[model samples]
Target: MSARRQRWEIRPPAPADVRERLGLPPLLATLLYQRGLLDPAAASAFLAADYATGLHDPFHMRGMAEAAARIAAAIDRGELMAVYGDFDVDGVTAVALLTQAIGAMGGRIRPYIPHRAREGYGLNNVAIGQLAADGVRLLITVDCGISNYAEVVEANRLGIDVIVTDHHHPPAELPPALAVVNPKQPDCAYPFKGLVGVGIAFKLIQALARYGKRPANLRGRDMLDLVALGTVADMGPLLDENRVLVRAGLIALNETARPGVRALMAAAGLAPGLIDSGAIAFALAPRLNAAGRLADARRAYELLLAGDRETADGLAAELNATNRERQALTRQLQARAEELVAQSGRAEQPLIVLASPEFNAGVIGLVAARIAETYHRPVVVIEQGGETSRGSARSIPGFSIIDIFDQCADLFVRYGGHAAAAGFTIATAQIPALEQRLLTLSRQYLRDDQLAPRLMIDAVLPLTELSWELYAGIQQLEPFGQGNPQPILMAPNVTAIDPQPTSDGAHLRMRVRAGNSVFEAIGFHFGRLAEALQRYPTIDLAYQLAVDEWNGQRRMRLLVRDFRRAGGARNGG
Candidate 1:
């Protein structure tokens, strides 16, 4: 094990109106105020996520009018239409949403999701030819087709009109599609710029509703489930319109989800009526993503759109198995990646770029995220194949992987994504050159302080303020992510009254006291820190206050995130 000592820093939140309005205890109020819900009305609205108030008019996006017009024309003339999507959860959800929406609009529609291992991502010429051969006159691409200039050109040549509805960053030259509906486009004026691929498709559906061309009886909230699934899975920020969509979508997901989602939740041992972002992130998303990661993405697409319970259950089981397989593969690949990083003798390099022919391309992004987290640096993992190498990248906050790739555009055959996550392809021979170029770019852009990992704390609190009433008051800041994160509070000199090792030493069950209040706390995935339990009877802990319910009992529990030896005047020692 490495002997690197973990550092601790505490920054207290500025006081606000949390105590007065919600009758909250002081510590909980400070944490809530720091998270930006300083006003009572705003706090109420944030928790409620008023579905009616949050949703935007679908026609607000730039190309909605044109895209909807074309689709409406296709419906009027009864032209064959195809919904093209990517293979991941976001892509699968987009395909499901659009195909369902279009079918409801009395339009003849078929769904097409590219094979992850074979055809790769985005709209390809081969798929275009196949669609054309099948008598498809109009093709609307979801989750992809923004940067497929050559493929779009080929699609037009094959007499297929393409409408690109994507969220990926656009290149210098746009694809020659009928209309591009990406909010990331330089000149576009979409109010909410943080839409994922499914969000874009949702906008198109909204536009159809405005034109009175939508399915007359289709419920809008029914589609929110898909929007929530894709948005969270793609790691889109849970703020602005995304926050609105996901908040409502989670409610819909829990109450009236599709057969596939219902079956998936059952397999994952999650209650459908009580789903949250955590459930989607940890359970549903991975299962849907597994099909694309290890096998054909079509399996996921089929599962989501299955008509019968038996079919949906079977597919969900298969996807669950695939997810298990994917998890094992990722572990193996991560070990190999760590070995490569060790051998390179350049661990401190600003950007990590590693390539191996044996690495699975599907899980490279996840591998990149793991490597980035471990090293506190940006990472790009590449899988070198016969003629070309595919790569996936994840970045730290201050670093932009897409911008870095844009600087070395000459080396890539294709590249696209947001600032944080990106994907690309290049000739196998250009890997070294591309790596060197990205490192040089990183050295120029990254500051020394930016490279160090820092945890942002919402506030510092005394132990006396942790109460059931205060915990309930904090619920006003619900559905947190991106701009709004779950608040972390630090309390010093908290004595662990009862500390017991749990579950093969992976966790700790403890009761801690601060002033007059005593709370049950669990330190998850902190078995390695067991030695510190005996060394420090009273310590400082950073944690989230939550209500843990078990067998009809409800009590406040501290979900311990980080801990350190207490210091300064407050330390009883």
Candidate 2:
């Protein structure tokens, strides 16, 4: 965690007229207004979260017709089809969802997830050749393939038609596949252009179901569990259509009778019915991604599609062990990267770029992400390969890290990613040049203020004002992620009582009181605050209000984000 004291950015209060105009509670209206929901009708629609009203017709997406027709033709002909996905959770869930959906329609479809260390990202000709040899007449890529032009051509040469269904940014020239179904394509006008890979794959399933009555009655809603898992795990925006999908998906996830989901929840220490997007992002996603990072992603894909409880439990335990291994390795690599940064005297630079043989290519992205979060700057961490090196980049909120590659497009062998994260391959000899070029670019593009991280508080609400009713209203903003965030409420002059490190010695647990209202607060990773709280008993708090459910009892709790001595300086990380 970053030790730097985050500069607080509190939103200005909402207009008083917003309450009467929207006909909602004061706090709910304020939260909605703060999120730019001013119109009465729009606010109602947003709060309703009605799936039918919110989700667009799948055919509304540009390539839906073509993609759906091609897949339908394959199924009608009884051709062997495969869903080729990336190694991450987003790709794994996508492969599972599409495979199951097609199989339910009497199509023999299997999943193929690339190994992060071996076959690498996107499509490889060798894997495509292997799939072709397995009698696969059709290949549909989920979460990837927008950038695999040559691989798609190779599939075509092997007499297999390819359909590219991805959400990543498309190239100037798309693959000559049978169909392309990415929402980010230049000509695509998907109202919500932010569907992650599985979200796009879900839309393809919806489109295929619309082809006929039998497909329509395939119980597609049962698959929302996969959609929610993938979307939140991949950091997709939680607004517009995505909000509706995820809200319903959470219901599906909670009520899922699938042995795989049940076992995974148990493995993650989550109550079956109490899971949320946060649990998915923090606990479930990492464990699922661990298989890809440390071993074969097929383990996770198989886990999601497992039929029996024993099979599911075995895979879930494997993923749990792999996650533990991944965590230990991440801690080790993070220390080394930080040590390298301290030694390089490059901590003050706008962009931190480092390359070493010790940095494993599979986990460099995690290291870069942690570095970027700690320093609030763009970061590039590369693994020194024999001749060509692979690098992963993480950016601050407003900056597009991929732009660093776009500006230096001529130097890389291959590159693709989103605004905040990207990956590239370049000649090892060109690393110094890449660093200097990145330095030159970051100076022109980044400002000093942007380098200092800001903690954004949604609104200021004293503890006395929080209530069970208000918490229920907040539920309307379900499945919060990238675009929509959980409300962070600020309460000033909070008195800290009995503040101390938790039993595990990894967090801070304390009782907080504001006026007559009191709440139990827990600060994960803020265990060091015990000393500061002992000195300054009175402090201000930035926190998210949550319900702690235990033994069938529930009570309001404060999940502390940060705190500082009242009228004094904030605690440094």
Candidate 3:
């Protein structure tokens, strides 16, 4: 089925003098202004995101002093410490970061990652008991444990000290851990609350380093590569301290000499220099996550901690194959989910809830996210077990999945996530009632227009303005991800000279002409638009600037986002 038509909302350009005031090109200034960076100092700081000035003080986060002190004491006393983490990329990277840091500081450390299909997310009593039996006295959790009130109690009962370092939304009642180092905590005064699990872990190490207790070789910046991987993989907003960490981390990532990192990059077909946030998100993160999605995530964690080239290469190859398998399975499940939604005649419903006993529990989140993006609505995919079902949900922009789960708290055994994504567990018998209740709530909260995707265009420029200088200036905004996305520019009255579908009929490629200028453009997944473009060859296109390299020469290209017939009545904007 064709995707829903998108509504365009073009932002007005900033004042002309913004260029003079901000010392940037007019287009760059306009983009920055639209992002609320109007002051010159702020714009300059954003453009030159130096880590030294950008990263927040580690001690500013509430509970940092206590967490650091406890960790230092444990190191001094030579207590056996265990780093417990989730199964996803964020959790695994956090585990690697903390374990490496602690080991470097002369502490005996072990990493414990729960299996996604078996033990599930967060801290568990069985694992705690096993660790305690192994003589572990200090347990540090990464990317999880915020909502594990009962598990925290279990750890305490086992005589294990727990320090929770997570970025997930905290519950009304906090856990009874020794220290909770989360910026989202109510009493926390941390300036940036958008740190991912690894970012929080980095801050903890930073605090330890400041106290002169960290390993001599393990500086805060040395782990920025891990920080960038986990933060970008988890979709943390690239603003404030997150921006600083990611920007610096990208540099570290490109220059990293770690055997595992180099091997993974080679497998992902990425070059060694000038890696960006997009590369990590699209190439590296998925391969790392493939292990957790299909099997044990410990392989991935060990790969990042691999000390030998042969070991790293073998792990990277395994993960690459797993990622390929994962992609195939995800596509199969997504097609099945679409058919189910269509068969149920719930096409117009605000929320899409799907479930099957055949569904793989590990891949439900990926399928839910894909369906939500395609339908432009909130989606929930559940994997039915014997008596209970596990569910993963993805939400649209305005709807908060976590907030919605909060409203229906009684429906699930346990639930936790961010604004746009979440997971839960409930009895299989409650599926029908949960679906109906969710539909009712969605109907009340969502508007008709909210169901359609909305494209926010930053500026409307003519083809004549597409100069190399403009593109170079825009490149200053590196490491774009959540909260700071690549700018989308609109060009109107571009005549479609010729449009043809790819050989596989999965995409549309064409040459567009504006006056005397011609530009090549590709519309991914827009093969269905070939016939329409033939009917009306003139279009107003929204796209992001891209460069195609051929024979070591760079040529401009347009990555088509959306388009409409030329001279049509402007809608939404």
Q: Pick the candidate with the highest TM-score.
A: 3
Ten contiguous residues with the weakest lDDT in model 1: 1-10
Best by lDDT: 3
Root-mean-square deviation of Cα positions for candidate 1 versus the true structure, in angstroms: 3.1
Better of 2 and 3 by lDDT: 3
- What TM-score does structure 1 among the candidates reach? 0.92
Per-residue accuracy of model 3 over 1-573 as CA lDDT, tens digit each:
112277788888888777678877788889899989988999989888888788888899988999999999989899999999988999999999989998999888899999988888888899999999999999999999999999999999989999998889899988999999899999899989999899999999889987777776766777889999999999999988888899989888998878999999999988878478888999999999999999799999989989999999999999999999999999899899999989997668889999898789889999999889888999999999889999999999989888878888888888899999999889999999899889989999999888978888898888878999988988998779999999988888999867989998979999998988889999998988888898889888888988877567999999889888777445443
- The RMSD (Cα, Å) of candidate 3 is 1.8
Clashing pairs in 1: none
Error of 3 at 60 (Å): 1.6
Taking the candidates one at a time, how many backbone clashes does each contain? 0, 1, 0
Cα lDDT of model 1 by residue, 162-273, tens digit: 9999988888998988888988887777788899999988889888877777775668888889999999999888877898899889888998647888888888888766
Tens digits of lDDT, candidate 2, 235-269: 99988888888888998999997888889999999
User: Given candidate 2, what's the lDDT at residue 249?
Assistant: 90
The lDDT, on a scale of 0 to 1, for candidate 2 is: 0.87
Show the lowest summed lDDT stretch of 10 residues, model 3. 1-10
